[model samples]
Target chain A: MTALLTVDRLSIATQARQLVRNLSFSIAPGERLGLIGESGSGKSLTSLALIGLLPETMAATGSIRLDGTEVIGAGERQLVALRGPAAATIFQEPLTALDPLMRVGRQVGEVVRRRLRHEGLPSSAPAVQTRVLELLSRVALPDPERLARVYPHEMSGGQRQRVAIAMALAWRPKLLVADEPTTALDVTTQAEILALIGQLVREDNMALLFISHDIPVVAGTVDRVAVLRQGELVEAGPVSDVLQAPADPYTRSLVAAARTFDTALGRLF
Target chain B: MNGTAGSMPQTEGKMTRRTIPLSLIVGGVIVGLHLLAGLLTLFWTPYDPTAMVGGRLAGPSLAHWAGTDRLGRDLFTQILIGARIAIEVGSGAVAIGAAIGVTLGILAAFATRTLDDVFAAAFDILIAFPTLLVAMLIVAASQTASLFTAVLAIGIAGSAIIARLTRILAKRVLSMDYIVAARVAGSSWPSIVVVHVLPNIWPTLIVNLALQFGLAAMAESSLSYLGLGAPPPNASWGRLLQEAQGTVYTAPFGAIAPGIALVTLVIGVNLLADGLRAFADPTRRGRR
Candidate 1:
């Protein structure tokens, strides 16, 4: 498979602190790649740097190519253009990710209208609303029509996550970057959300870059896994190879920790 | 929680929860009184605000609701007419201060550099001087200040406080993920600020406006009392207070009438502002 999104020796820095150093990864067209790392291990920062979503305080060096278009040092307008139709992000906290004041339907509709405007297509409010409802339905949100009129704050965490997923898929981007999309969800809800993302990526034939610290969470969702520790990639291989037969000492430690944590949690329940 | 949930709509049942309605009523009453006074003055006052009905320092009677000042002008009528000037100055000055302050604050927050530093320094410098002193100096520098000039001077003096508040609120809103989401969605800076940023900070601004109305009213009255607010021939509570000050010992009602009016108006505004602050609080709403 050919790479749809590629990062070569990408380094991101905030003020005097280096976050992601010499990070290189790629997502093949229609492939799901999981980048697993503990907290502050540069996983999320690498993803943000790839999409040019890093704050003004941060600086990045090295190449970030999304479908052969270099994103490094791209102007804000250029980044904006790339954000919707080319690449989109699903943040960790869905509750915080979506705008509270705006109705979920309008927010989803905005992406479609914005993309249409960017492509110089005529967009009507009714037409956008219809498309937004359709997208919500596509995400398996029950009662799409009713849901469209509701604000983000009015919805449950699971429902909000579904809305966020719908928004990410609104532009039908070739690549979706999900950063701990299910971290805040319960175990059952987490399973459902991960399943939804996996199903959607397969159906759309879209490349997905899933970032999580949970080993089993990514194991069941992604095709390949790249493990990071202390801002460096420690292991990269097929999910089966990395999870079932872990190579790096850090990766083994993670697997052991995840198993123990799950066991402890199960005992608690 | 169940009892609280059940009382969400009923008036008596939700008395505690219905603070917003109560606030609206109070705000409406205060605003309505000011408006009615203004309209009545435009058409006619009970007696001419400037007219001397009898001897100076006359006590309250059926002919004069409040009494007569040293100049023998009807105190009640003067206050009724002056309500328009006081409300105008209070609301107008707050509007001006908020507009300038919120704009500069949001700009400084978004800019976040030497530009922000410059605005912060300027804001701090302006705020360092006592607001009354600043208003006095501005009024002193320009001889014969009109209603508009008084409002402007008060607004300029009040802007420093508003700007600092707006900057803090705007910075908090600017850091929210939805703001980042808007940016990623390709929203222009102005659009983001207006559509996303402004709406989020609107409650804060409303609370500030209410609080400032009370402050501006007191300031206007003080300035007028000091002979710096409105010129002669224009009715103001402060100016009325100044006129009655001389005869306070002889006929205390002369001074007491305008003084009471000023205190009542300020109290009403402050209470309404407090109510608004509570009404606009989301956590309080959630608890209910």
Candidate 2:
């Protein structure tokens, strides 16, 4: 299968420091690739750089191709076209990701309406609302109709993350980038969200790029894994192989830490 | 068991419902006065504000309610007319100031570093000068102060402060995660400002506007008192005060009437703004 999203030797630098340096990865359509790293390991930066969402102070060099279209030098107008319809991001903090003032339905509708308008397609308010409801339902949100009228702040954190996922799916993008989508959620909610994401990626036939600091969280979800430390990729292989026998010393250390943490909790019980 | 039972009652008492804020009561009274004054002025005044009634320096009586000014115009009539002027100048000046401030502040926050610095420096310099002094200088230079000129002067003087406040607020809002989400979702600058930043900062802007309205009303009265606002024959409270100054000892009510009108209106606006600030506080609402 052809890689739906590809990053070749991507490097990004902020004013004070280099964020991501010479990183490259690819994910095939309908395949999930996990990017695992510790805090400040540049995983989030790489994701931002890929989507051309880096701040003005940050400079990026190297190539990022979304279905063969170069995003590195894309203008603001072009980036707008690329963002929602072609690629969408589900951020870590769902509360912050969704607009607090807007109704959940309206927020979801905005993505569809905006993308349609950007693509020179007709968009009506009612049609957008209908589509928003459909997207919300697809994410298994109960009482999607009533829920749509509520604001982000009115919903629980898990519900908000579901809404965020619904918003990402609204535009029917080819690639979905979930940056720690379940980090703020409770354990059960996290499992449900991870499962929801996995289910959606398969159903939509979209490439999934899941970035997380927790190794075990992504272990059961992704088809393959890439370990990054301080902006450098340390290991890349099948998920089972990496989990069973991590060759890189840093990867082994991370796995050992996760094992120890899990064992200590088990002993307390 | 006795201690636990006692604590339950204490906790219940502690959770007693919060009362309405004092600021709300004061604000309601202030708003009520403005509404009453507006309604009263529409139909009638004590006497023709421009008409010479009884005699100059007449004491308070049933015939001339708050007494008569040096020009023999009824003080009560002038005060009512002054209310209309105050509301017009106050609301108009604040509207203009908010428009200029919000626009420039948003631009300063969104624009490149060099442009932002330039705007920041310019507004800083403008704010450095005392607002009332600047209004005085403008009125002096023009040599004529109509409603339009007075409002223009007041707005110009007030814009720097509003702009500075808006800039700080906008910058803070810009750094928030939702703004990043908007950007990542492909929202344009204008859309981002209108849909995101504007709604979030509206309560703050509204409170500030109300406070500025009160300030502008007082500024207009001050300028008029100094013979720099609202030409003669126009019944302004400040003009009434100025005309009543010489006869204050003989007809104290004449001076006192307009001064009270000015004071009440200022107090009303301030109270109203304070009430709104309290109302806008989400924590306050949550507690209630």
Task: Estimate the Cα RMSD of every predicted model relative to the unseen true structure.
Answer: 4.0, 5.1
lDDT of 2 by residue, A108-205 (tens): 88777887787687798887888888898888887788878766766777888888888788778888999999999878788888988999999888
CAPRI quality band, candidate 1: acceptable
For candidate 1, the share of real interface contacts preserved is 0.25
TM-score of each: 0.91, 0.91
Write one digit per residue (lDDT tens) for candidate 1, span B105-177.
8888888578888988988999999988998888888887788878988888898889988887888888887
Q: What is the lDDT of candidate 1?
A: 0.81
Model 2 chain A: ten consecutive residues of lowest lDDT: A149-158
Question: In order, how many clashes per candidate?
Answer: 0, 0
Query: For model 2, which pairs clash?
Result: none
lDDT: which candidate is best?
Answer: 2
